[model samples]
Target: MSNAATLAGGFPDLSKLPVARQAHWMRWFTAAAIVAVLLAIGRAFANGQIEWSYVSRFLTAPVILQGIVNTMVMAVLAMALGIFLGIVVAIMRLSPNPVLKSVALGYTWLFRGTPLILQLLLWFNIALVFPTIGIPGLWSARAVDIMTPFLSALLGLGINQGAYTSEVMRAGMLSVDAGQYEAAKAIGMGRLRALRRIILPQAMRVVIPPLGNEFIGMVKATSLASVIQYPELLHSAENIYYANSRVIELLIVAGLWYLLVVSILTPLQMLLERRFARGFSQTAR
Candidate 1:
């Protein structure tokens, strides 16, 4: 019976209706199968192979804590460096001078075109290419000594980050209304002052979301610094596992700590996004 007829005949209309979207049953079956597979994974994880004891034991160990601190420091410092350079690059890219614009484009192209790991390795082994680093006329320091693991890693990761960040900043700045720039200029404001006081305030709303994601990514990306022998969290985990052969356990410990750090940052990112968005919303209204 047609559904319309069944509804119209208000007398004992308890009959089952035919499916409107026939493919829905297959979707339900697929979802059920996926749930079963996930359950199987959970059972495997619950098995004895994963040593939870070591995870608990070494999670708060002093060395692990130190590694966590170093990772945090690198992420913050690298992001700060990236933001500083990125702002300059973005402004240069937007400037009237063709030279500044070309230079900014070249900088972004060179860094972003290459692999990040390769950059890190190059910075670490810069001594092989340039034995000494510093001014041409002034006294110089040995490249290997001056470009320590920490410094090299920062230069590699942070500078690369700037290239990406510059694009983000440029996009955000462009998202700001052109009329706002004109309005600011109409008030006799200099270009820098206009951006600082007017355009940037609005542009930040668009910038915040992507910038937050980048910061969160940076926290984990700091693990790459380990390759340069910088003792961030993952490197410390590697050192522990190397000595005792509890590879999976130490890995789990590191994973948990990484999750914890990301958890802490997630709320802060949300808070900042909301703070920036609040003004935009009010202005829109």
Candidate 2:
């Protein structure tokens, strides 16, 4: 029975045996239970009191198509405005002068502190305060006429987005090496030129991921414009439901469209991230 004695006697050794594989029965049981619950949920939805036919009918309707087009248009325009303001505010925040820094800080605080919907409403009703807005005597127009639902939504969304984007941009700028800034100065380059040519270019690798996520969030946030009568996707869906009273069905259709848009943006974001991270190692990315 002694393995050493048996080995000494020219018998086969048993101490060098292979390790036994574990079955992990509990893990298998947990996974199976989760799958069973998911199946039950799917079955419930399949038999739910929803009119799928209406969803299909309005899925490609002309109004729905136009709504989606408007949604994309606003998203792009608002994001462009946001990016521009963000860069300016970020630079101001980083500037050496006290006035510029304080102004930038105040702008960020005012916008980021309030509700976006409230801002939209304020812009929409700005005529109540200003009445007729113009260059004193040169020209005059009703504030209500100039600040339509489209313009109100644009100003509110774009300005609010700038407040948040400014922080993102500042963080990206700070991530760049101080040595790089000094190097730019060593060549007699000014702060703006250094940032434009050197610092910002390097910081982009770190900035793109978060910026892409924010853009995706902007796409979803466009739905909030519906409250102001902007004819984006959710507004159009609500119009159909308001007429026929198929509330859940129309909501489901909107949800599906939102999901589709977000899904497409996710892959595109990944592509942008990869493009910016080209020089970095896999682990760094």
Candidate 3:
């Protein structure tokens, strides 16, 4: 019995490790510092000279609600279009044909190199280039005069998003093992069929997490449409603040709404990532 007690006493207690104890204290100190800074900032904002009534009025406005709806609509539509285009561009980037590869590279380079805001402006003013979009012999008319700000914003956002998403998709696709492709071909699958059925499924499992982040980014990027009077969330907030002259208050309201939406989206994204991760583990087993 005394031998057992001696052995137990000989073991070093983890709490006696000075480095580990110091590390724990360091983490606690860092967290307290962060909390202190946030509290200070919040107190300053609350006690500032700005009137709380303006913030209250802006939050309760029906226009702000409508702006939220418009923001969701644009995000959904743009993401749908972007994902579709991303698939095509990814395929092109991986194609054996030199022309297709060149075209895909050029498209990605052009879009990614330019600022999204510039792309939005260019699309909004696209009529300057062609003036008329229809065939010269058939139905020529001024295209710029007809295109609305909303349509232009949608096109610009969707196309640019597609370019970036394509590179992301290509990276995912390349991550899949070459052995899988060979196995699909051995079973008499056509090239396109193998890619679609065998490769894409696995690639998507890799791509989903980043795709979720891209969707969130697209939601924020839609705010650029407000510059052209598309009345998205930021624009709606701006309209209210312009009338009430409560710049910071209205901004805080908009920031909170954006935070809420992103918070909701983040969980859904995690759920999808988990679902996709199951397949990988099962395959590994």
Per-candidate Cα lDDT values, in order, are 0.91, 0.92, 0.88
Worst 10 residues of 3 by lDDT: 13-22
What TM-score does model 2 achieve against the real structure?
0.88
**What is the C-alpha lDDT profile of model 3 across 23-82, one tens digit per residue?**
487889999999999999999988987687777777758998889889999999999889
Per-model C-alpha RMSD: 4.9, 4.5, 4.6
Better of 1 and 2 by lDDT: 2
* lDDT tens digits, residue span 160-222, model 2: 999999999999999998999999999999999999999888888888888999999999999
lDDT of 2 at 258: 87
TM-score for candidate 3, residues paired by index: 0.86
What lDDT would candidate 3 get against the real structure?
Answer: 0.88
**Off by more than 4 A, model 3:** 1-32, 282-285
The order by descending TM-score is 1, 2, 3
Give the winner by TM-score: 1 or 3.
1
lDDT per residue (tens digit) for residues 1-285 in model 1? 676575755565556656566568888999999999999998998885988888899999999999999999999999999988998999999999999999999999999999988999999999999999899898888998999999998999899999999999999999988999999989899999998898778888888889989999999999888999999999999999999999999998999999998999998888888887775576532
Q: Which has the better TM-score: candidate 1, or candidate 2?
A: 1
The number of residue pairs in model 2 that clash at the backbone is 0
Candidate 2: segments with Cα more than 4 A from true spot: 1-33, 282-285
